[model samples]
Target: MTTAYYVHVTIDQGKNVMLLDSGCTQSAFPLKEFQKLLFQFGTQKISHQFIIADIDNAILLRLDFFENHHCLLDFQNAQLKIRDSAVRCCDSQGNLLKVNVQVRQDTVLPPRTERFSMARLSTKWVQGTACIEPADTVPGVLVATTVQDPDKQQVHLRLMNYTDREIRIPAGKIVAMCLAANLTRPAPTESASHGQLPEHLKTLVEESCQGFSPEEKPKVQALITEHQNAFSSSQYDFSKTNVIKHGIPLVPGAKPLKQRPYRHGTAQEAEIEKQGQSLIREGHGA
Candidate 1:
């Protein structure tokens, strides 16, 4: 009989939250969220080899080395400067259809306008199609990106004016929703059954362990020996204890103390009492 062990890990990269799935043959990420990491994907060949689709039909991409990684989100697009202008359309007889390009007075343009806003994305694959939408319910339109030219960071976006009123897109507005089609493939495996780790991965794990320092090797071995039961056993018992009842002890002779009235305080008190007696003789206590 073989005992299978699985562990769950929560990965948070800025606003992105992902989980470590053991049943999943490979790891996966949302394209929009993936772009926010300080990591880059490897060439498609290496990626395609390791990142196959899981049973759920989601394609899993593995992370390459973590060095000199770059984020793909467009922080500059948080606030875009919208300038107002007029576009004149003339009829055959030079009759102009004048529509003022309405710009909101509160709208502020960025200092530089020669270059349009662009969005960068990251992926291990050479090229693939993705669906881009607006994050919020707004009039901002996506100019769109080509699935053919998803170079390292060449994905650019253009905003189209859909509404008649020229308005300002406030800063920090999340306006891009990009999603890639589900890449489906078989999970990496050596045999049909699921209890064993992939052969390639087993080799890599062995190599990694072999490369550990001499002092660290014993620590790793100790951890494995200590947690051997966790890997070999499938049953876990969590018997609840009578926590509240057993927490504090009841003392038999406990009693509440009573307050006492003021008595002898000082010589000043005795002198005051004598003065009070004299005053009472005179029919006055003050």
Candidate 2:
């Protein structure tokens, strides 16, 4: 079991403890008395909705609160900081834009966990105007495609931790970017913009002697049609690939030696077994 950490806080003049959870979206106190829990927050003049929880601690602090208030937690030095918000936007072509996303609070993700957590989105577009897709920029993390709420600027990021160790995502780190798709498509570049889908696809093979087999051409076309949004103009970016494997090389030697297999823990063994069964089901394994 993982250990828990607590911080001393005062609620309604009563000294109490609150669990600091980075993975939590909202912070709540157990008791009914909901006075302003004073602490070092930012200058945004923020107000949080109070909710009730049955936990022993006076408050169950979450990540969103810190992000909204622009508060930074320095775990190494035991320091809490409040800073003015700094949002970023790198490129914007027509209605297609890329905006920065930051974790609002300090949190540690356990291994093999997946959840949609709210984070600070740095964009000026109003709701319903844009859709969110993964930018495939961050490494060692998985970002799922999520649409921005049309009525609000809020964005919930689907984060998945693939490693077996805890991942410490500190506040203000550019963990991911939202690929915003809004009205008014970006101006097309290259042959795809001017011609119809079939014509543009023909251009790819117009000059080549090679041709797709009649039996397989339809299937290939269907796959592209299903994800047409991913292929705009000619610059194609489908998304990131997620797979874990390592290749071992043998050295040239006069003597031969046999080696034992590497061992994995219970969790890893179960996962390997599951994947092996999957490969077999997919006819990749006998």
Candidate 3:
């Protein structure tokens, strides 16, 4: 897919969408698209294809290459067909309705700061839709797959800018096929699940106020429900942000020792990431 407008990025592009930029052209990939393509076909690697500027194209379908390779392109109708019988799966992809994610505010995603925002889409839906993973679609940014609001049709996106410079996303620009797929109805909120208190909250209340009188149970439950966010789920959670931090102090002029990063394979990496993410998600860590 190719975006209509050109983007200028500061840092080197990510691994998935590598580009070999020269002249006025560059090759880009994965995309601002729902349907993505990753090929790297053909055992022959050209002397070119370096890590280059990421533009709006996933496939660089140059006219000269088709002419040189004796392959024909239907330029008039704008279609390409491979006659090889081995290539069977290409034709199986059916029609798709690409959804456009529009921003409410002109978002400026700074490289070092985390950005989280809500924006509505063109199509209104009763359920959440997953983001298409904006790879090189909008240059250095990637919009995370998140649940959308059913009523407002609002989408929560965690915008990450891998580039050095800030990426300015205007209020009404659509990056090519920036698409989304509708997901199943999101899980009910706390009030929707039960009457008021969720199962966990009820359990917490029962466990904490077991010794309280029957007359005070309702009041206690109400108090706990109102302050539920301050409640910790486990030993690891310490998220009462207003509370003054208390930690053991070191003597004056004591230099903190540098700790080596924990090394584990992909499994540990994923777990560590999840741990860090959960902190941010729950508003425990900034």
The candidate 3 region of ten consecutive residues with least summed lDDT is: 85-94
Point to the candidate with the largest TM-score: 2
lDDT of 1 by residue, 199-233 (tens): 33344345547979888865665444433323422
In terms of lDDT, model 1 sits at 0.36
TM-score of the candidate numbered 1? 0.22
* Per-residue accuracy of model 2 over 1-286 as CA lDDT, tens digit each: 2324444433445544545567878778677655445542222233565566677634666786677766665442223454654212122121213456776777567887877776776655532444455555445567776656533455677787776677777876666655434444545544335433544455543333247677776566555544444543433322445444455567777467689999899999999999888767755677
When sorted by TM-score, best at the front, the candidate numbers are 2, 3, 1
Backbone clashes counted, model 2? 2
Q: Which ranges of candidate 3 are over 4 A from the true structure?
A: 1-97, 126-135, 175-286
Better model by TM-score: candidate 1 vs candidate 3 = 3
Give TM-scores for every candidate, taking all chains together and pairing residue i with residue i.
0.22, 0.32, 0.31
Q: Clashing residue pairs in candidate 1, if any? A: 81-109
